[model samples]
Target: MREIKILAVVVVLTLITYWGVEPFAHSQMHPHVDPANYDFAQADKVSAKEQVDEKKEALEKAEAQAKATGNEKLTHIPKSEYNEAVKFEKTINDFWASNKEALSLTGNATNGATLVQANCTACHSIKKEGFPPVMDDASSAAAYGVVPPDLSTAGKLYSKEYLVGFIKEPTLASKVSHKFVDGRVHPMPSYSWMQPQEIADMVAYLQSIAPDKMTDKEVFQNACQRCHGIKYGDMLGGTMAAHTPETNIKAYMGKVPPDLSQYIRSRGAQYLHEFINDPQKHLESTAMPRVGLTKDSEEKVISYLEKVGDSKKAQREELGPKFLIYLVIFAIFAWLWKASKWRDVH
Candidate 1:
């Protein structure tokens, strides 16, 4: 009997710790529905407010189980899976050093291509004969139903500028890519809006791709075969956009919100940069979360922004300034955003 009671106390305390301790240390939860007037302190808060009732019921079950027996079978309760996610922070930081001289985007195109082959090709294959996999939302690209396009021939299909633009705002592709079809899924999100140097490197890879290496159709099929089809984005177009930040923000996209296809159409690159680093400051209704990109990531991405907004060209065409250009333009803006954040803390 004593053992059962002790176990009960432990179980209860564990639940309390998740509710209290976790919230106090790390969290930035805003009301899932209202983007504006949301709290940033809940970034690490584990309480899934979007499904509050489900969680409450889960806690009750645990409490009941503890009351009845010493063991816990609270299977209904779901906790964060941060442990499973790729630690992009550390990895992206190391990415620069690993490919510094060879296939390095920080320098020139040829170097970046090598890095892309080493890093991106494994997940996304650009050759029909190469055969990577399909986007399936699972291990294979088929998991998301997207077919990765062939980078081998993207150079001929699109220009270097076009490639960079696609990476910056993938949705900008309707105007940028050879494929008129909308091909992407909920899980097959775009990396164009992601870190810039990486985009540059990948663009450089696309630019260097030789058509003699593979056929365009095969390249398209092989490259796109690993991911979901283009309809993925268009299918959920409005609903996903309007969905609560909690549901839409990082749930589908990365920690940041999805505005590249939509927001950038109206707002400029400077706005996008500021919003990327600090979304809450610009739009009170934004559900976006800052990923704390490194200085290099910020600079590289800003440089890539030039390519994304162009309404012309399906292939390589230099659009915006190289990576650092946006950083230089938006440095003051980001600084102001930083000051605002600091002010809020005090």
Candidate 2:
């Protein structure tokens, strides 16, 4: 009976910790957030189609209202809604969907090279083609507030759609619309005026030079090393070095980006996914812009993070059950020992 009482107390404490204390602590520490939608194609398609339809519907409604009121002009339409219709006749997403086919069109890499030389060499570099940035890292950072990434592996790192959208509108493609609002000019100007064939040719030129298969470290370098550094082991000195100095980044960004050495363990995978997809969703008005990595590229980058930050994850998972079994056996032996000691007391 005494043993049963002790066991009951232990169970009650465990239950309280598991059901009450743990939950309360977690709620305080990490508020609930929606899981990441890893399906970018589906999400982007649906969202873009919806926005286009909604805008078209609004414009049609305004026209109908104007017609009913005998006003040939859309004078009755709300100025804000009218402006939205006119300004965003086709969003970046819409443009991407419409122009996706151009990716397959045959293009001249020479022509693409000439076009890039003429327009892009001022700000960006095609290191693979021996085209260095017009300015060094310090000069570039001072001039543009951020060092432009080398386009050597951009074809492998980013999706074709993202490249197209970014070429069309850098602010919208990178999901930094908020930062560029209220007449704020983005550092990279919109190339919406460029012909679709020109955009496709640029993408083809990039794709021709990028490696077909990249290791996780390579993915991290191409996708994330421009801004975030990993200070784990040799990574800081090796693969995870940022292009620009930390001081320059801090001056431009107003804060040094955190070392991502332990971010996998600290923020967890889901938070990292959502945060990377859209920084403003997690931290409003943050300086970090959406990286626009494709699903595969994002996965590779996260996998590399896990490899560095949680190197013993597999070992820990394998040993966890063994430790639990040992604990149960120990508990039983302890109870038996206690019973023997108190055998004569009652």
**Most TM-score-accurate candidate:** 2
Every candidate's CA RMSD: 21.5, 7.0
Q: Work out candidate 2's RMSD over C-alphas.
A: 7.0
Predictions in order: lDDT: 0.42, 0.76
In candidate 1, stretches whose alpha carbon ends up further than 4 angstroms from where it belongs are 1-107, 128-131, 134-142, 175-188, 192-198, 212-346
Give per-residue CA lDDT, model 2, range 1-346, as digits (tens): 7778988999999999999999999877766654454444444455445545766677778778888988757744454555664454455446556666665667667777777778887899888889988888778877777788888888888877678778877876676765677887877888878888898888778778888889888888777877788887333444456777878888767798888889999988888988887675567568898788877788888888988888788999999999999999998899889889988996
lDDT, model 2: 0.76
Q: Write candidate 1's Cα lDDT for 247-313 as tens digits.
A: 3233333343233333334655556555544453454424333323323334444433333333333
Candidate 2, position 312, lDDT = 82
